[model samples]
Target: MYSTHLSPMQTYLVSENLKKMVSEDWRREKLHSNIAYFKTKMKNANRTVMPSGSAIQPIWIGDEKVALSVSEQLKQKGIWLTAIRYPTVAKGAARLRLTLTTDHTHDDIDFLVKSLVECTYD
Candidate 1:
Protein backbone atom coordinates (compact mmCIF):
# COMPACT_ATOMS: atom_id res chain seq x y z
CA MET A 1 0.00 0.00 0.00
CA TYR A 2 2.99 2.32 0.36
CA SER A 3 3.69 4.21 -2.84
CA THR A 4 7.31 4.98 -2.01
CA HIS A 5 7.92 1.53 -0.51
CA LEU A 6 9.87 2.87 2.43
CA SER A 7 9.99 0.56 5.47
CA PRO A 8 8.37 1.73 8.67
CA MET A 9 11.73 2.35 10.28
CA GLN A 10 12.85 4.32 7.23
CA THR A 11 9.73 6.45 7.44
CA TYR A 12 10.20 6.99 11.15
CA LEU A 13 13.80 8.11 10.79
CA VAL A 14 12.99 10.40 7.90
CA SER A 15 10.04 11.91 9.73
CA GLU A 16 12.08 12.47 12.88
CA ASN A 17 14.83 14.20 10.96
CA LEU A 18 12.31 16.37 9.16
CA LYS A 19 10.69 17.30 12.44
CA LYS A 20 14.01 18.26 13.98
CA MET A 21 14.94 20.38 10.99
CA VAL A 22 11.54 22.09 11.01
CA SER A 23 11.54 22.63 14.76
CA GLU A 24 14.95 24.28 14.52
CA ASP A 25 13.89 26.48 11.57
CA TRP A 26 16.48 25.01 9.30
CA ARG A 27 15.13 26.63 6.17
CA ARG A 28 14.68 30.21 7.25
CA GLU A 29 17.69 30.60 9.55
CA LYS A 30 20.32 27.87 9.22
CA LEU A 31 20.42 27.88 5.44
CA HIS A 32 20.68 31.65 5.42
CA SER A 33 23.50 31.57 7.99
CA ASN A 34 25.44 28.95 6.03
CA ILE A 35 25.02 30.82 2.75
CA ALA A 36 26.09 34.07 4.30
CA TYR A 37 29.11 32.48 5.91
CA PHE A 38 30.10 30.89 2.60
CA LYS A 39 29.65 34.11 0.68
CA THR A 40 31.74 36.05 3.15
CA LYS A 41 34.50 33.49 3.10
CA MET A 42 34.58 33.36 -0.68
CA LYS A 43 34.60 37.13 -0.88
CA ASN A 44 37.42 37.37 1.65
CA ALA A 45 39.42 35.06 -0.59
CA ASN A 46 38.95 37.53 -3.44
CA ARG A 47 36.39 35.33 -5.14
CA THR A 48 33.22 36.90 -6.40
CA VAL A 49 30.15 35.06 -5.27
CA MET A 50 26.86 35.42 -7.07
CA PRO A 51 23.95 36.03 -4.73
CA SER A 52 22.57 32.67 -3.72
CA GLY A 53 20.36 32.01 -0.72
CA SER A 54 20.22 28.29 -1.31
CA ALA A 55 22.31 25.27 -0.30
CA ILE A 56 24.00 24.90 -3.67
CA GLN A 57 26.61 27.50 -4.58
CA PRO A 58 27.86 27.67 -8.16
CA ILE A 59 31.20 29.44 -8.48
CA TRP A 60 32.00 30.53 -12.00
CA ILE A 61 35.48 29.73 -13.29
CA GLY A 62 34.73 30.81 -16.85
CA ASP A 63 37.01 28.26 -18.53
CA GLU A 64 36.18 24.59 -18.83
CA LYS A 65 39.70 23.33 -18.26
CA VAL A 66 40.25 25.50 -15.22
CA ALA A 67 37.04 24.35 -13.65
CA LEU A 68 37.90 20.69 -14.31
CA SER A 69 41.44 21.07 -13.08
CA VAL A 70 40.36 22.78 -9.90
CA SER A 71 37.77 20.12 -9.28
CA GLU A 72 40.40 17.40 -9.70
CA GLN A 73 42.75 19.09 -7.28
CA LEU A 74 39.99 19.43 -4.74
CA LYS A 75 39.19 15.74 -5.13
CA GLN A 76 42.80 14.89 -4.43
CA LYS A 77 42.52 16.97 -1.28
CA GLY A 78 39.54 14.85 -0.11
CA ILE A 79 36.89 17.24 -1.32
CA TRP A 80 34.11 16.16 -3.69
CA LEU A 81 33.19 19.31 -5.57
CA THR A 82 32.00 18.98 -9.19
CA ALA A 83 32.83 21.09 -12.23
CA ILE A 84 29.93 22.23 -14.38
CA ARG A 85 30.52 22.80 -18.07
CA TYR A 86 28.92 23.12 -21.49
CA PRO A 87 25.68 21.34 -22.48
CA THR A 88 24.70 21.65 -18.86
CA VAL A 89 25.42 25.38 -19.23
CA ALA A 90 26.55 27.77 -21.92
CA LYS A 91 30.13 27.78 -23.12
CA GLY A 92 32.59 30.03 -21.23
CA ALA A 93 30.48 29.72 -18.12
CA ALA A 94 32.21 26.77 -16.54
CA ARG A 95 31.85 26.62 -12.78
CA LEU A 96 32.26 24.53 -9.65
CA ARG A 97 29.15 23.53 -7.75
CA LEU A 98 29.65 23.65 -3.96
CA THR A 99 27.00 22.09 -1.81
CA LEU A 100 26.78 23.42 1.74
CA THR A 101 24.97 21.48 4.39
CA THR A 102 23.85 21.87 7.98
CA ASP A 103 26.55 19.33 8.80
CA HIS A 104 29.36 21.56 7.51
CA THR A 105 31.42 23.39 10.10
CA HIS A 106 33.01 26.82 9.74
CA ASP A 107 36.42 25.20 9.48
CA ASP A 108 35.10 22.99 6.69
CA ILE A 109 33.91 26.00 4.72
CA ASP A 110 37.12 27.90 5.38
CA PHE A 111 39.22 25.01 4.14
CA LEU A 112 37.17 24.75 0.98
CA VAL A 113 37.54 28.44 0.22
CA LYS A 114 41.24 28.31 0.96
CA SER A 115 41.73 25.31 -1.31
CA LEU A 116 39.79 26.97 -4.09
CA VAL A 117 41.82 30.15 -3.78
CA GLU A 118 45.04 28.19 -4.01
CA CYS A 119 43.77 26.29 -7.03
CA THR A 120 42.28 29.22 -8.91
CA TYR A 121 44.09 32.33 -7.79
CA ASP A 122 47.59 31.06 -7.23
Candidate 2:
Protein backbone atom coordinates (compact mmCIF):
# COMPACT_ATOMS: atom_id res chain seq x y z
CA MET A 1 0.00 0.00 0.00
CA TYR A 2 2.89 2.35 0.74
CA SER A 3 3.97 1.62 -2.80
CA THR A 4 0.62 2.90 -4.01
CA HIS A 5 1.39 6.38 -2.69
CA LEU A 6 4.81 6.57 -4.30
CA SER A 7 3.25 7.47 -7.62
CA PRO A 8 -0.20 8.41 -8.79
CA MET A 9 -0.75 5.44 -11.10
CA GLN A 10 1.04 2.89 -8.95
CA THR A 11 -2.08 1.58 -7.24
CA TYR A 12 -3.87 0.78 -10.48
CA LEU A 13 -0.74 -0.88 -11.81
CA VAL A 14 0.69 -2.61 -8.79
CA SER A 15 -2.62 -4.20 -7.90
CA GLU A 16 -2.08 -6.63 -10.76
CA ASN A 17 1.36 -7.55 -9.48
CA LEU A 18 0.06 -7.75 -5.97
CA LYS A 19 -2.46 -10.34 -7.10
CA LYS A 20 0.27 -12.33 -8.81
CA MET A 21 2.46 -12.26 -5.73
CA VAL A 22 -0.36 -13.56 -3.56
CA SER A 23 -0.93 -16.40 -5.99
CA GLU A 24 2.59 -17.69 -5.48
CA ASP A 25 3.07 -19.74 -2.31
CA TRP A 26 6.44 -18.41 -1.25
CA ARG A 27 5.61 -14.83 -2.01
CA ARG A 28 2.29 -15.10 -0.25
CA GLU A 29 3.95 -16.38 2.91
CA LYS A 30 6.50 -13.62 2.84
CA LEU A 31 3.80 -11.04 2.33
CA HIS A 32 1.81 -12.42 5.23
CA SER A 33 4.82 -12.21 7.49
CA ASN A 34 5.50 -8.67 6.47
CA ILE A 35 1.89 -7.75 7.03
CA ALA A 36 1.98 -9.25 10.50
CA TYR A 37 5.01 -7.21 11.43
CA PHE A 38 3.51 -3.94 10.35
CA LYS A 39 0.14 -4.80 11.81
CA THR A 40 1.79 -5.40 15.12
CA LYS A 41 3.73 -2.19 14.94
CA MET A 42 0.65 -0.19 14.07
CA LYS A 43 -1.40 -1.88 16.75
CA ASN A 44 1.15 -1.42 19.47
CA ALA A 45 1.88 2.21 18.82
CA ASN A 46 0.50 4.64 21.40
CA ARG A 47 -2.27 6.41 19.57
CA THR A 48 -3.81 8.35 22.44
CA VAL A 49 -2.44 11.59 21.09
CA MET A 50 -3.88 11.10 17.65
CA PRO A 51 -7.23 12.55 16.70
CA SER A 52 -10.26 10.23 16.65
CA GLY A 53 -10.04 9.69 12.91
CA SER A 54 -6.39 8.72 13.12
CA ALA A 55 -6.92 5.40 14.74
CA ILE A 56 -6.55 2.17 12.79
CA GLN A 57 -9.16 -0.12 11.15
CA PRO A 58 -12.80 0.88 11.61
CA ILE A 59 -12.03 4.59 11.57
CA TRP A 60 -10.25 4.46 8.22
CA ILE A 61 -11.86 4.25 4.77
CA GLY A 62 -9.39 2.64 2.35
CA ASP A 63 -7.12 4.17 -0.35
CA GLU A 64 -9.23 5.49 -3.19
CA LYS A 65 -11.96 7.08 -1.13
CA VAL A 66 -9.44 8.06 1.48
CA ALA A 67 -7.14 9.71 -1.03
CA LEU A 68 -10.02 11.60 -2.57
CA SER A 69 -11.48 12.73 0.72
CA VAL A 70 -8.15 13.58 2.27
CA SER A 71 -7.27 15.69 -0.74
CA GLU A 72 -10.48 17.61 -0.35
CA GLN A 73 -9.88 18.04 3.35
CA LEU A 74 -6.31 19.18 2.84
CA LYS A 75 -7.26 21.70 0.20
CA GLN A 76 -9.46 23.31 2.80
CA LYS A 77 -6.76 23.01 5.42
CA GLY A 78 -3.22 21.70 4.81
CA ILE A 79 -2.60 18.20 6.13
CA TRP A 80 -1.88 15.07 4.16
CA LEU A 81 -3.55 11.80 5.09
CA THR A 82 -2.36 8.38 4.08
CA ALA A 83 -4.95 5.71 3.30
CA ILE A 84 -4.99 1.92 2.98
CA ARG A 85 -7.41 0.52 0.42
CA TYR A 86 -8.64 -2.68 -1.18
CA PRO A 87 -7.42 -5.06 -3.92
CA THR A 88 -4.59 -5.07 -1.43
CA VAL A 89 -7.40 -6.58 0.63
CA ALA A 90 -10.26 -8.95 0.08
CA LYS A 91 -13.36 -7.30 -1.35
CA GLY A 92 -15.33 -5.18 1.13
CA ALA A 93 -12.34 -4.81 3.38
CA ALA A 94 -11.07 -1.26 3.56
CA ARG A 95 -9.79 1.23 6.10
CA LEU A 96 -10.01 4.88 7.00
CA ARG A 97 -6.52 6.24 7.63
CA LEU A 98 -5.45 7.98 10.80
CA THR A 99 -2.18 8.60 12.58
CA LEU A 100 -1.13 9.54 16.09
CA THR A 101 1.92 11.62 15.55
CA THR A 102 3.71 14.70 16.84
CA ASP A 103 2.37 17.25 14.38
CA HIS A 104 -1.31 18.11 14.96
CA THR A 105 -3.46 20.28 17.12
CA HIS A 106 -6.62 19.18 18.91
CA ASP A 107 -8.57 21.63 16.80
CA ASP A 108 -6.98 20.33 13.64
CA ILE A 109 -7.98 16.85 14.67
CA ASP A 110 -11.34 18.01 15.90
CA PHE A 111 -12.82 18.68 12.49
CA LEU A 112 -11.36 15.56 10.94
CA VAL A 113 -12.32 13.35 13.79
CA LYS A 114 -15.84 14.68 13.86
CA SER A 115 -16.27 14.33 10.14
CA LEU A 116 -14.88 10.83 10.00
CA VAL A 117 -17.12 9.63 12.80
CA GLU A 118 -20.13 11.08 11.08
CA CYS A 119 -19.10 9.57 7.76
CA THR A 120 -18.58 6.14 9.26
CA TYR A 121 -22.15 5.71 10.44
CA ASP A 122 -23.57 7.41 7.41
Candidate 3:
Protein backbone atom coordinates (compact mmCIF):
# COMPACT_ATOMS: atom_id res chain seq x y z
CA MET A 1 0.00 0.00 0.00
CA TYR A 2 1.21 3.48 -0.87
CA SER A 3 1.84 5.66 2.19
CA THR A 4 -0.23 8.77 2.56
CA HIS A 5 1.56 12.10 2.10
CA LEU A 6 0.83 15.68 3.03
CA SER A 7 -2.10 17.43 1.30
CA PRO A 8 -1.47 20.34 -1.09
CA MET A 9 -2.07 22.91 1.61
CA GLN A 10 0.21 21.07 4.05
CA THR A 11 2.90 20.78 1.34
CA TYR A 12 2.71 24.50 0.66
CA LEU A 13 3.05 25.31 4.31
CA VAL A 14 6.12 23.08 4.67
CA SER A 15 7.69 24.65 1.61
CA GLU A 16 7.08 28.11 2.95
CA ASN A 17 8.65 27.14 6.28
CA LEU A 18 11.75 25.84 4.49
CA LYS A 19 11.99 29.07 2.49
CA LYS A 20 11.83 31.10 5.69
CA MET A 21 14.59 28.97 7.24
CA VAL A 22 17.00 29.78 4.42
CA SER A 23 17.04 33.43 3.47
CA GLU A 24 18.62 34.81 0.30
CA ASP A 25 21.09 36.81 2.41
CA TRP A 26 22.20 33.71 4.29
CA ARG A 27 22.68 31.72 1.08
CA ARG A 28 24.60 34.49 -0.65
CA GLU A 29 26.90 35.00 2.34
CA LYS A 30 27.66 31.31 2.64
CA LEU A 31 28.43 30.99 -1.08
CA HIS A 32 30.73 34.02 -1.04
CA SER A 33 32.55 32.77 2.04
CA ASN A 34 33.07 29.32 0.54
CA ILE A 35 34.43 30.78 -2.71
CA ALA A 36 36.76 33.10 -0.84
CA TYR A 37 38.11 30.17 1.16
CA PHE A 38 38.75 28.20 -2.01
CA LYS A 39 40.50 31.16 -3.66
CA THR A 40 42.81 31.59 -0.68
CA LYS A 41 43.69 27.90 -0.58
CA MET A 42 44.49 27.83 -4.30
CA LYS A 43 46.60 30.94 -3.98
CA ASN A 44 48.63 29.43 -1.17
CA ALA A 45 49.24 26.32 -3.27
CA ASN A 46 50.40 28.45 -6.24
CA ARG A 47 47.44 27.22 -8.26
CA THR A 48 45.04 29.30 -10.30
CA VAL A 49 41.35 29.35 -9.38
CA MET A 50 39.26 30.67 -12.23
CA PRO A 51 36.42 33.04 -11.39
CA SER A 52 32.93 32.16 -12.60
CA GLY A 53 29.48 33.70 -12.40
CA SER A 54 28.24 30.19 -11.77
CA ALA A 55 28.84 28.14 -8.64
CA ILE A 56 31.40 25.86 -10.26
CA GLN A 57 35.01 27.06 -10.47
CA PRO A 58 37.74 25.33 -12.42
CA ILE A 59 41.31 25.02 -11.24
CA TRP A 60 43.49 24.57 -14.30
CA ILE A 61 46.06 21.79 -14.03
CA GLY A 62 46.95 22.05 -17.75
CA ASP A 63 48.03 18.42 -18.29
CA GLU A 64 45.43 15.69 -18.76
CA LYS A 65 47.60 13.09 -17.06
CA VAL A 66 48.13 15.24 -13.99
CA ALA A 67 44.48 16.14 -13.78
CA LEU A 68 43.36 12.53 -13.92
CA SER A 69 45.90 11.40 -11.39
CA VAL A 70 44.95 14.21 -9.05
CA SER A 71 41.28 13.39 -9.39
CA GLU A 72 41.91 9.76 -8.48
CA GLN A 73 44.07 10.72 -5.55
CA LEU A 74 41.49 13.10 -4.20
CA LYS A 75 38.85 10.39 -4.55
CA GLN A 76 40.95 8.10 -2.40
CA LYS A 77 40.91 10.83 0.21
CA GLY A 78 37.06 10.85 0.05
CA ILE A 79 36.78 14.15 -1.78
CA TRP A 80 35.08 13.45 -5.07
CA LEU A 81 36.01 15.76 -7.98
CA THR A 82 36.00 15.46 -11.74
CA ALA A 83 38.84 16.09 -14.17
CA ILE A 84 37.69 18.17 -17.14
CA ARG A 85 39.57 16.82 -20.14
CA TYR A 86 39.75 17.17 -23.93
CA PRO A 87 36.64 17.41 -26.13
CA THR A 88 34.89 18.94 -23.17
CA VAL A 89 37.77 21.42 -23.18
CA ALA A 90 40.69 22.14 -25.53
CA LYS A 91 43.73 19.88 -25.53
CA GLY A 92 46.11 20.67 -22.68
CA ALA A 93 43.40 22.69 -20.95
CA ALA A 94 42.48 20.05 -18.38
CA ARG A 95 41.29 21.11 -14.94
CA LEU A 96 39.64 20.05 -11.70
CA ARG A 97 36.27 21.66 -11.29
CA LEU A 98 34.85 22.35 -7.82
CA THR A 99 31.32 23.34 -6.95
CA LEU A 100 30.52 25.52 -3.97
CA THR A 101 27.18 25.19 -2.27
CA THR A 102 25.58 26.78 0.79
CA ASP A 103 25.29 23.34 2.40
CA HIS A 104 29.07 23.02 2.57
CA THR A 105 30.79 24.03 5.78
CA HIS A 106 34.16 25.83 6.12
CA ASP A 107 35.78 22.63 7.38
CA ASP A 108 34.55 20.75 4.33
CA ILE A 109 36.10 23.34 2.03
CA ASP A 110 39.36 23.20 3.99
CA PHE A 111 39.55 19.43 3.69
CA LEU A 112 38.96 19.60 -0.05
CA VAL A 113 41.60 22.27 -0.52
CA LYS A 114 44.13 20.39 1.58
CA SER A 115 43.43 17.17 -0.25
CA LEU A 116 43.87 18.90 -3.59
CA VAL A 117 47.18 20.44 -2.56
CA GLU A 118 48.50 17.13 -1.25
CA CYS A 119 47.31 15.21 -4.27
CA THR A 120 48.88 17.68 -6.71
CA TYR A 121 52.20 17.37 -4.92
CA ASP A 122 51.92 13.56 -4.82
Compose the digit string of candidate 1's lDDT tens values, residues 1-122.
Answer: 42425789999998998877786775657667888999989888888665676788999788899889989999988999988888677998888888788788888998898888878522
Error of 1 at 27 (Å): 5.9
Candidate 2, number of clashes? 7
Candidate 2: residue 36 Cα off by (Å): 23
lDDT of each: 0.82, 0.46, 0.82
TM-score of model 1 relative to the true fold? 0.78
Compose the digit string of candidate 2's lDDT tens values, residues 52-102.
332232333434665456545654554555444566554444444554333
Per-model TM-score on C-alpha atoms = 0.78, 0.36, 0.76
Candidate number with the higher TM-score (1 or 3): 1
Estimate the Cα RMSD of every predicted model relative to the unseen true structure. 5.9, 11.9, 8.0
lDDT of 3 by residue, 36-105 (tens): 8878877887778876756688988888999999999998999878998887789989888888888988
- Model 1 C-alpha RMSD vs. true structure (Å) is 5.9
As for candidate 2, its clashing pairs are: 54-98, 60-95, 60-96, 61-95, 61-96, 62-95, 63-85
Residue pairs clashing in model 1 are none
Q: Alpha carbon lDDT of residue 79, candidate 2?
A: 50
**Best model number under TM-score:** 1
- Candidate order, TM-score descending: 1, 3, 2
